[model samples]
Target: MQKKQSEWKWQWTKVYDDSKWLFTEWIYPNKLKDFKGKTVLDCGCGCGQHLNFVAPYCKQVTGIDLNTPRIAKKNTRQHKNVKVVEGDIAKIRLKKKFDIVYSIGVLHHTDNPSKSFNNIKKMVKKKGKLIVWVYSYEGNFLNRTAVEFLKKHILLRLNKNFLWVISNITAALMYIPIYTIYLLPLRFLPFYQYFQNWRKLGFKRNNQNVFDKLNAPQTFFIKKSTVKKWFNPKEFAKVHISHYKGVSWRGSGVLK
Candidate 1:
């Protein structure tokens, strides 16, 4: 389990160190509102990117991850209100609760995503919020199927160095053609805007994205209904579940 988790640490550390941009807000819609003065907990926080984004608005932001605490700490070093801790989402215990417990693109990589969801839920204060985003089975059906097989039969078995090389190669194959199209006058078309975002991310970040997707050992593509069940109506006041271009499951709700 530790080895499997360490793979993600190495991949994300490389990405964080290499990428020129820093993401601050939720990538999906239904973003949090009125975070000012609230306490936030970012479970599986990678390199403290989101923590740095939220720290200025919230009273405090705590970032926890099974690996990469050192990177996270260094990334958020300038923010006195931000704390970085090394811990697993499924096992870490804290006495305090936060106004918001957010775990995006993290839970589904766990050995048991449902267990991690329950553990994260415990960190939310009563009437507070729990936000999550997981890879979805409904969207990207064909592409996901192909990658799933590669992940199980090839990528997971490769050494870290070899896997990194293959991931970058895969990124090149994907980006070259798509970005070529993006640069043409076709980009002015309505639907071309979708692929335009990828071009805007630049080559290295796109490579990192692909690496993170294919290299992880425990990537579970979950169903929307399964995610809805994860948030029991008894525990949450209202739950909102949606998807982004059929690629991810986005959910947010206030704890009861």
Candidate 2:
């Protein structure tokens, strides 16, 4: 089972305090203009950071995850008007559908993103919205190689005791480029852009036992065309691709 089930929840519950850019950059700006009075659903609402951002704008917000402890831990956030439930985002049964149903960096981890997303679609009222930001295959050869290596080998081989250690080390190292650029302003620097958002992946690493949970078999990838086509049949008008564009398709759309 993915560690996100139990171990991950207990291990990495309080990681959403920061990472505002991740939530805002990926899915927020594109979909949020319509959110002021909407009912929104955040699937795989990890530490509730993104949920926290969206909660105030919507009529009511519901966050669902498979990990019970994580849900309880988020109660510590004491976010009013936001309900945290322990359930599979992919298999949730809700009485009320939403005006917006979205997942951020979540679908890729599912055994079948298609089924999970389609299930998400069922939760949205007609003409509602769906937004998702997934892993991107867009980039240079070396960058892709390194990311694939870490996902395939390093993470899978990590044991519990050393998992957190590895996450810390990696997370710290990812900041080096940021600091280097900050300390020295250069028009052109190697790995500058690559490391700019390095904190996003690093944040994922810094939290709990995520190094183990990131080892999901389905995390590999999907093409942009494939994802676009999948949603097209379901009344979703293609929105835009963010993370996985050019190489793969991590996109957002509105259900028509």
Candidate 3:
């Protein structure tokens, strides 16, 4: 777990310049309006990118990360209503609850994602909201097998400079299929929706995305049933979960 945190801290330091809102729109498309005047918390906030999008409408927002708290603080320093703190989602317990709490593309990388989810859910006040997005096990066979094998056996063992070069080469090669075959009418293509989303990003972001995937020390693809179990029907007034873009699960609920 410490290695995971150290790996992520190094990863964020390498790509700290990216200012894009990446998954904010996809993860919370119809939910931004709910953030207005609300106190929000971004668990595992990376360099505070999502905080930039939420701070404008939120009354106040606090971001916590196990690794990049300093970077997150500096990145979101422009927002007077934002606070960045160092903490692990699986263990940290704050004194106050939030109107909205979210973790995007972060929990799945934790050593104990289930524990992290349960711990963070406690931070949401009764009648407040909670949202999370994580890699889904049902649709990610390649990631679970081939990608996992490569990262653990090969990519992770390589020196950072060599791994960086490989990431660049891989991202460049991916552009060929993304622009050509991906634009076709073949909806059967693996990760069709995910690839389409990637088409909108620039080369730098694409490289960063590739590097992130290759450098990550570990990943866990959560099952749909597992995600369902996380949101207790009795505790949540309403809950929604979907297989997001065929590669991940997006879930949200209003606390009762």
Candidate 4:
């Protein structure tokens, strides 16, 4: 876990961007208006990008991360309502719970995702909302097989500097297919909707996206069944779990 933490710190230091549209995609059914005047916690807030979006509407927003929070603090310094802190989502427990708690694209990266999910849920106030997004196992067959093989055997063993260069090259190579073949009306294709979202971003952000996937020290492609198990009916109500872009899962529930 220490080694994985170090990899994330190095990754965050290299890339920073606020994908507002991507945020919307991940936080659906729970709109930005849902956060109005509410206390919010971004369980694994990286660089405070998402915090920037929510701080304006929320009564108070706290962004917590496992890595050093220097970038998050700096990025959110202008927002008086925002606080950035260093903490492990799988271990740390603050004194107070929040009206809305979210962990976007973070839990799957943790060493113990279920433990982390349980820990983060404890931070949600009774009747408050808990939202999470994770890589889905159902539609990520390519990622789970070929990509996973390369990552585990080759990419993970490369030097950070070299890997960044490789990521840049890979992103450039992908730009062609993304704009050409991906533009076709082929809903049956894998990652068709996911690639559509990527087309909206520029080259720089796309490169950052590529680097992020390659730089992660570890990751878990969660199943829909596992996501269902996390939101037990005895503990939660109004639970909504949906597949996102056929490549991921977005789930939200009201704590009981």
Candidate 5:
């Protein structure tokens, strides 16, 4: 699984947009200012981008992933204070807990998302923050419908390269109506922003989400209430859901 995940990272970087706001500017940090001087643990930290988001604010930021040691080493070296480790989020040995533990767009990919949350709990301190982002079923209809159609009929049968072209073509046109609604002059609105993500722009996803190519493994989408049900108010205070729209479920929670 680790080897596969490393390959996945490599593939993702190839198409994944490094300059997109998805990595740099987060929806909401749940008292973003509170992150300063606090300990943070980033689960499923790919090539080490999110760590850069909170690194300046936190006293220490630790990123763990199943990516190759070389990539991890490179990330560690690039960021003087950042610490990157290679390991499965399901099983890892850590002596200390963190003030904030986050797993973004990772839980739903697992065989058992609830189990992933359970394991993360062991590494989070009492009254600590737990941030997560997973696919949502009742979030947006248009986006969900488009993705379902794309994945089921379009992506399933077509090769990754072909699918990339189709998805982006569809995404580029998506900006038209959006720009119109924004009241921006349709002629002036830059469609380039839609492709600027670098992923769709470059027609990439080299190894990330490779599972989609293998057989389109079973994926799950949960409701907001279901996520809230996972935590007891006594031990975990349910923070407000951050409003985020992504290719998938974007911002969901900041559990405390």
Candidate 6:
């Protein structure tokens, strides 16, 4: 288990510097813009990529991750408003509460995503916001199934070095379809929603995304209904759930 964790850490560390806030506005929209003078906590802030993007706007930004040694501290060292801590989502405790607590593409990677979600909820102040993004099981069923099967049967068995090779190869192969869609007018068609975000990223960012998906040791797919239930009605209000390209889920709500 430790070895697997280390592999995951190394995988993320390789891309830490390359990480980009590809679509902060598209994902968080008005929420990020409204974060002035607020305390923000980026749970599982891999490489502090999102922190780097939002730190200028927030009064303070705290990023905590189990892979802190690998990425967090180094990535956040230059940012005065940002502080990086090493901790587990399911066990970390802090006295201060954040005005905004968000974990983008983070919780689903944990062994116990539900527990992580509940734990992070405790860090949000009453009337504050909680936002999360996770892989969705709905839509693109066949493609998702095939990727899951590969993750379970093949990718998980490979070491970090080998997985890096495989990820690059996979990224290269993806260009075939990506370019095919680019050459045709498929991107303009509403029916081809799957690669729309990818098209916006161009090749390099898209390749990094492919590596991110193929190299991670753990990945979980959640349904919109299940994600909605993760936050309780008594504790959360005005919950909004949105699905992107049927491949990802973005959810946000105010703490009551």
Best by TM-score: 4
Cα RMSD for predicted model 4: 1.4
Q: lDDT scores for all predictions?
A: 0.77, 0.63, 0.86, 0.89, 0.60, 0.76
In model 4, which range of ten residues has the least summed lDDT? 1-10
Candidate 5 Cα deviation (angstroms), residue 74: 2.8
- List, residue by residue over 58-157, the lDDT tens digit for candidate 6: 9999988886544766776778999988788877899899999988888878888888899999999999999888888776475467877887788878
List, residue by residue over 1-256, the lDDT tens digit for candidate 5.
3234433553444443254356433434564567788998988776665776777788898888765434555655656668888777877768899998888776776667777777887788877787777766664454356556656665666655665565556546645665455345443333223323434332233223333333233356666666665554655765545434432333323345
Candidate 5 — which residues are off by over 4 angstroms?
A: 1-7, 16-32, 67-76, 140-146, 149-158, 181-218, 242-256
lDDT tens digits, residue span 1-256, model 2 = 2334444454444344456655666774464556788888888776676777776678878887776535544553666778888776667779998888888777777777777877877888887878877654444344357655676776655565576676667666746656766446663554444454454454553443234334333464655665676567558774665543233345677788
Compared with the true structure, what per-residue lDDT tens digits does model 4 show for residues 164-210? 99999999999788788888998888889889778889888989978
How large is the C-alpha RMSD of every model relative to the true structure?
A: 3.7, 4.4, 1.8, 1.4, 5.9, 2.9
Model 3 off-target regions past 4 Å?
1-4, 17-22
Top-lDDT candidate index: 4
Winner on lDDT between 2 and 4 is 4
Estimate the overall C-alpha local distance difference test score of candidate 6. Answer: 0.76
Clash count of each predicted structure: 0, 1, 0, 0, 6, 0
State every prediction's TM-score relative to the real structure. 0.85, 0.75, 0.94, 0.95, 0.70, 0.88
The TM-score ranking, best first, is 4, 3, 6, 1, 2, 5
Q: After superposition, how far is residue 45 of candidate 6 from its true place, in Å?
A: 0.8
Model 4, C-alpha of 3: deviation from truth (Å): 5.8
What number of backbone clashes does candidate 2 have, counting pairs of residues 3 or more apart or in separate chains?
1
Which ten-residue region of model 6 has the weakest summed lDDT? Answer: 17-26
